[model samples]
Target: REQADLQRVFPDLYMNSLSNVLTQGMNRKKKHEVEALAAVVSWIARSVGANTVVDVGAGQGYLAQVLSFEYQLSVIAIDACSHHGRITNARAERIKKHYAAKMHKSRSEDRNLNMPKTVTCRVLSTDTFKTLSDSLLQKDDLQKANLTGKGVGEHSLEGLPDGNVPSCCVDSKPSLLLAGLHACGDLSVTMLRTFLECKDVKAVVSIGCCYNLLSEEVENADSQCGFPMSKGIKSAGLSLGKSSRDLACQSAERWRCLGKDAGLHNFELHAFRAAFQMVLFRYYPEILITSPAIGRQGKALRRQHHQRILESTLHHEESAHSSPSLSQKNCKKKGSCPTMNSAEAGTAKNKGTFEIPLSDTGNSTPKSCGAADFASSILEMDALFRGVSFNQSTKCEATKSVDKYSLFEKFSRSGLCRLGLHHLQDINFAGLWKETEPFAELIGPYWSLRAALGPVLETILLLDRLLFLQEQGNSLEAVMIPIFDPTLSPRNVALIAKKI
Candidate 1:
């Protein structure tokens, strides 16, 4: 479809406004990115001849509204974030009213029974996948909604038919499954795997985000099983390796080069900020402070606010540094700090010679480690953070061998963890999950960050698995489509299988 056609179909007026806002500062040519995305969505819809489309991360339900209203296709928009989901639901209600009014005015009768039912928008977090699915499978409201072209009222999926699968529209299992725009960490992966596991889901179109959150495990079911394999075949399914960050780094490098070419010193800063903004929005919900009068804040005030944040963080670091324990002294004595040397101390005669006494209550002097091993661990962490490229085999080994307690010990002693903050152990993952739980509840949804990350990592690792599926004499009825947009970093790569 053409740009005008796509615009006519899009339901979210706010998203249209956002497109305009995003384009305001960009160059004329670059301003077409949103338009291009809309066009791509329209093209995919037409290509699949989809009668019903469900967007997994349907923020604001812009695309869902448009598809339902414009193409006359039933749409189900789902999101883990309750705030966004509520906004989308409200927008859909507004559009439904508008459409009903327009039909009455134009004297056009609502003719078709299957002509797009009221868009079913739900606030569903990705974290509670199994729970949500199980609840959905038992819900009667959804079953009635599916059979009749009516919407499910305020109800859980407790009595819905086939609610075991996330998508309610897949009863007869439509020929097409669509997830247009999705977000970081795990959401994107969940969509791809959902498509893979659900038999009625014939085609999938998805875009993914958040590479680092993906699981390192290779044997996940979602990643291994693309099509319906026999019980024996399923068990024998091969494992896909770890998700690679090479593509993400490549994108970063390109941005860096672009910045250098333009003589911009802080190109990487801007790039990093843009990348971090997505993470902060998804993981740290508090960072999004939406004030109605925020636009009125002056440049000076904004700068002051930024400075205050930086200063506050620095102050916290300083406070943490002032208190030193016995372990810290031993860490220092081990010569972990490259700058501290015997020769430098000798030259600076007035320098204080601080020593910890060998006592219990006053803190006993801790034993020191061999200088070599301490230095080696430090170097290893440094190397990991340096973004050095490593092959999948080597990378997996390195990650598995890394000791969490030692890293925590190092962090506790030197406070370097507070400074660099690069190493991400299993405990860090656990803590992140714990932290995200309350936020998920605040948003009125249950989305497991780990489950989402696992599937996406599975999808990336299973790029080869798709190739294997094709190689194993599975007919070319389904084509693997890796959705990669140069403008936006590749979030997801989906395999679309069509029944020829």
Candidate 2:
């Protein structure tokens, strides 16, 4: 059956919701996400008679803000990042002021119109669920007031600055719906576990992201991972490696963008990376190692492809060992060396070919290799790999250079693999270029295909969590539900469960 048919068959199960007044100032994507999430949580909250909500990984508290102000449900927005909490509090306060002014204007305009009670939002910068008992422990009204000194329902001074306590700390509010909007990786699993462990959390709504960041339970096949949490799934010996999990996170929306005609320019970088990887392996066969990936550095290299590599002005202890002769010509007595940026690179386009020199047959001592030769090797790799042809005139510039041989060799031995060499088998120029050309052509479709399987893979992962929740007891109703638009928000599926 079609998706529409599935929606028709299980309308309530899907937990569809419409955006409301709370979404007024937010962006379109965020507004839609907050609206859908809040509506579903409100429905679940009403079903379970939960007036309080504990939002885990509530960065900026978008859902929490909506639940508290629009739905009139008291919410505790919890995040580990203090910066995020501060921003959330500031935004909430600004919105509250705007809404208050709007309400006052409405009341003066028409006395007949009903005025809703003013709502407040509080942000707590701590992992609230980590110490559940400490936060949730009950105390006498007088004792609680003294312990907190704040009014009952007002923010408490528990583990947060300026008298901010989690909603769970409000002793009078025992029942709460635990919710997380795209709580990343292990945190999503943590939310589900907390729901089962804590009796006060009446229900849970979890939308997870960053599957690749999940911690594995068992190191090998014998060990259990965070995913496949259900006993049956674990018993079946199922596992998704970090690579597979990353594939599951590829965005279909990005693939659609790449499918457009304008996306043709994007292919050049991929082809260049592929060619560069071949070059790395051809000269340094040991560089094909993949365990310690060049992750963020590789991405930076790709994004800033046009940046020219100035001779090593900055030296790390590790890189310093490779070469000691620092160039004085390019290096003035005091100032820093000039590096390439977008504007500079745009004006001076270099398209000349870079030739890799063959190793000397004679036993030439490491000291004999001059800085110019090392600089040539470094520029050759950096220029071609980064998709920028180096200005041959600048090649002769006496710039401080590191011994590329010892540097990359030691790097390879230490398991630091170059990017784009992950599945690269052949290092031949003609063959690699030919494979890269077709590979570039197929990237759009290949990316889309991987993205297409995302929801299916995500469903499997969610079902595993839900099944684990159900296995805890028969008194639970747990299932994966579509809560947001998939195209607009790739992490649109949510795992919602209530203790029946």
Candidate 3:
């Protein structure tokens, strides 16, 4: 993917759409996207002279409801998830009641609002999608639609020529214009293919997301892949490696807008995750290869980590009183033992380090004693293991500062135990984190750069799709437009095509 394509695409290729999301049960960000996309779908429907709008991957049917009730376009909302269809229908009923109440408030003579028909179907292929699209337009579906005033199948689409009528559609005229908001991977490409293949589907408005799920032709040519759709790309034999494809979905703009402290906090999380991976690699190599996913231990354990750190720091007195043998009173007051008071305990707590002064006595605390020294009162293992130095601290400046390695180790055990690896023995998590901790600081800058590079990958993909549509013929008018604020919706660009 060329970086220049980004400049080329942004300045000229995408049409900017503006609107507010008014649908219920949606967050502010989702509302912005839905409203903008619904507006575009309405415009395309009017331009293409299509009476019906088929919203594929309708999710909970936010866009579908808007296009139907707000824009007054006949709609058929389809999703692979059966539960989504049920939710959409339920929500649609609520919306319909709201509309009815509004008309009553105005005291206007109003007819019933037509609800978008819900269809739960996994659209796998062009033929499969075509069958679903065609069947819903037949006389049987039309009779069903008559129950509501001029619903999806019963829409008047008289002007479409014989070429636009499918073999299955005898007398029914469902001039459908397809619309998809964040259609995942192959489903988006499948809609485009279906639009070209099915006669009744005269136009398409699609916005795709989840680039990571896209299959590559290079991986297996037999599989109907989504990437490199254009002859331009296929001719070049280009492939977006799976890792880079995953990067394409990262929203640099969203990350860039994050507050300074928030951004650094997120970066620290990435560090913890990286070190945890190192733990798996060192201790459970076979399990790491077998079940690669540890499932976001950094995120799940963060609250617990912070609580433990706070408690260990603030509750030093509680731990200090527990073991009388390791108590400061047990040591020669003027000996190598460091004194602890409210101030010293507070300092140690904030520093998140457990420190014990090294002694000249042959029975001196080992260099590693500092690793978990705050808990020396609790463990009291020093008396039992005389020669075996259980708490050896590595002599490193970075390790001397704040012992995040211990915090990371704490996180690692929780993660490992979550995966039922508690029975494994002799796993040195502190040592594992120490080896990789130096690279942790680089994560913030590296992530920023990766986020910046994401849009380039996304641009190349959209360009390939646009070029593919153009490669079809001049009879098709196609475009990739910015339909939502990128800050609100990272996958904001929509791929739209209409028969000219």
Question: What TM-score goes with each of the models?
Answer: 0.43, 0.59, 0.70
> Model 2 residue 206 lDDT?
91
Instruction: Kindly list the per-residue Cα lDDT of model 2 for residues 391-444, writing each as its tens digit.
Output: 323332322232223223322211213332232333244444555455655754
Q: Predictions ranked by TM-score, top down?
A: 3, 2, 1
Q: Candidate 1 vs candidate 2: which has greater TM-score?
A: 2
> What would the per-residue lDDT of candidate 3 be over residues 21-95, giving only the tens digit for each residue?
235578778777776677667777887788788899989988888887787778888887777877887788888
Q: Which tens-of-lDDT digit does each residue in 1-500 have in candidate 1? A: 01233334334322223333223334433334333444445555566565455666665556565556554556556554446555665665666666676678888756421122222333233334333333333223444433322233222333345433444543543444555564444554555545554444445555444444444332555542222122333455633333233223123323323322121212222232233333335544453453111121123332333344346436535644775453244234532211122332212111333321111011111234344333333333232222111122321132323333222232222222222223323224334334433333222111122323443444444454354335434433444443434434333344444322
lDDT of every model, 2 decimals: 0.39, 0.54, 0.65
Shift in Å, residue 473, candidate 3: 0.8
Model 3 scores a TM of: 0.70
Top lDDT: which candidate number? 3
Model 3 Cα RMSD, Å? 12.3
RMSD to the native, candidate 1? 18.5
TM-score leader: 3
